[model samples]
Target: MPSLIRPVLATGSLNRAPQPTLPADGGLVLRPWRAEDAPAVHEAYQDPLLHQWHGRSSGCEQEAAGWIARWRASWETERGAQWAVADGGTDELLGRVALRQVLLGDGVAEVAYWTVARARGRGVAVRATTALTRWALEDVGFHRLELMHSTANRASCRVATKAGFAPEGTRRSALLHPDGWHDMHLHARVRGD
Candidate 1:
């Protein structure tokens, strides 16, 4: 028996093509991850701060390649949408942005992203995330999008705020990092907001 509530998005509503590249302000484009980016991803994962925040490492280019393959496969599975934030002209990767834990029926996903060392202070994550949020909420019909980061990560708070995700509240001892459990701040944006 069907429930009373209607799905915010239909099962077959999304696709990877037709608008695969999401354009951002500045010269940034959010494109699908490529195998060639393994080296850069591997290198980015080596940053101690990134390692601490993400709690995972690429370990090698091959592993990063596997990750890229999985990111591509997610589009077909309708589980997630990941993008490589790259320069529109040079095609050099600057960061990554993703809609993770996608729930199509509910029209919700959590945003995730990271910027390379060279891109960190330049607002790459903010631009890429803003582009993705617009695409998901405006173009793709998601009802809501959420962003969460460790409270200790002040930079991420800035990115989330700048990207239009207003802080909802905090979850205590929410995530485990290498150091220990850390509290997280929840932020979100909804349709028409």
Candidate 2:
């Protein structure tokens, strides 16, 4: 079975260098999550909106630390990448962004994110998503990137459009939240687009 298409992006490429800190507009920086951010992460999860949309919580500072560990390790594993959205001037934790379900051979991955209540409605998600998408598609050579969210998540839909992800279609009952199953809307960006 050697007669086949080669991988679009090599696996080791991502782990070759340390994950980068991406700078976005509006004085935002997307950096690697640090150990000390555990407390802030834990507190952010307490927001009801987070539970409503994400359906998961940090539960404790220790669990949040585990999240930090897992995200940091993902870089080395080359399975995914994540960043903490911080205020460039103050270095305050504000949100998170990630490329999840990365498939190097297919040159595709899913984009996901959330912002703290204080940072919402201020375009934080849009800026972070734009920065991460550029890095993933332009710098890292991914062919396509996906942004999927519940159809009920109008905020995420707005962020996707602002970040240049074109609307694809709706996937009926694609995800389960704490409340119930939700219809998922898929938005995507191809490299040349």
Candidate 3:
């Protein structure tokens, strides 16, 4: 008869590593959101177009605090990851870009982003999304990245296209928007490796 011992895994090895803070070009940075960002985030959420496009509600101070709290918990739990896009020089919150719904077992992740109204048309979303995708593929070791947008959101679709994501396909009634159930155009980028 032989006695067997089970192998023990290290605690850190069982957990997802924390994402690194990285800077993008044009004085833009994507880093973890600070508590002080709540006010600006709340204000950005108030934009009707953002709410309509992203399904985010207009938030008060308390709600913004709660949002930040959720973001913190998500990082701790490894369920998702969010970052606040800011001006590198002034540190002002410009918008948000998230690599969320990370399927660790599958080595895949989905990206979502929003830009403040004033920040639109400046290539902010493209730059932020590109930087995040690079981080995910190169640093985080993610094999695949996915992005989706409502077909009606031509601007967002353009951003996805410009970010080097290829159009995969469209899913009918994939998302429930303010108007109704909408079709979503799916895009994907795979790591060269």
lDDT of 2 by residue, 1-193 (tens): 5848999999787999999999999999999989999999999999999999999987799999999999999999989999999999999999999999999999999999999999999999999999999999999999999999999999899999999999999999999999999999999999999
- Higher-TM-score candidate of 2 and 3: 2
Query: How far out, in Å, is residue 128 in model 2?
Result: 0.4
- Cα displacement (Å) at residue 163, model 3: 0.7
Please write out the lDDT profile of model 3 over residues 1-193, one tens digit for every residue. Answer: 6537322222232145665577887889998877888888889988999878888775487799789878866777666778898888888787889878876656777999999888999999999999999887876677899999999999999999999999999999999987788899999998972
Name the weakest run of 10 consecutive residues (lDDT summed) in model 1.
10-19
Q: List the residue pairs that clash in candidate 3.
A: none
| Model 2 local distance difference test score | 0.95
lDDT by residue (5-115, candidate 1, tens digit) is 999988767664532888998999999888899998999888888888899988899999999999988887888989999999999888899989999999999999998
Candidate 1's TM-score reads 0.97
What's the ranking of the predictions by TM-score, best on top?
2, 1, 3
List the candidate 1 regions with Cα displacement exceeding 4 Å.
16-19
Please list the C-alpha lDDT of all candidates, in the order they appear: 0.91, 0.95, 0.82
Ten-residue segment with the worst summed lDDT in candidate 2? 1-10
Model 2 vs. true fold: TM: 0.98
Model 3 clashes, total count? 0
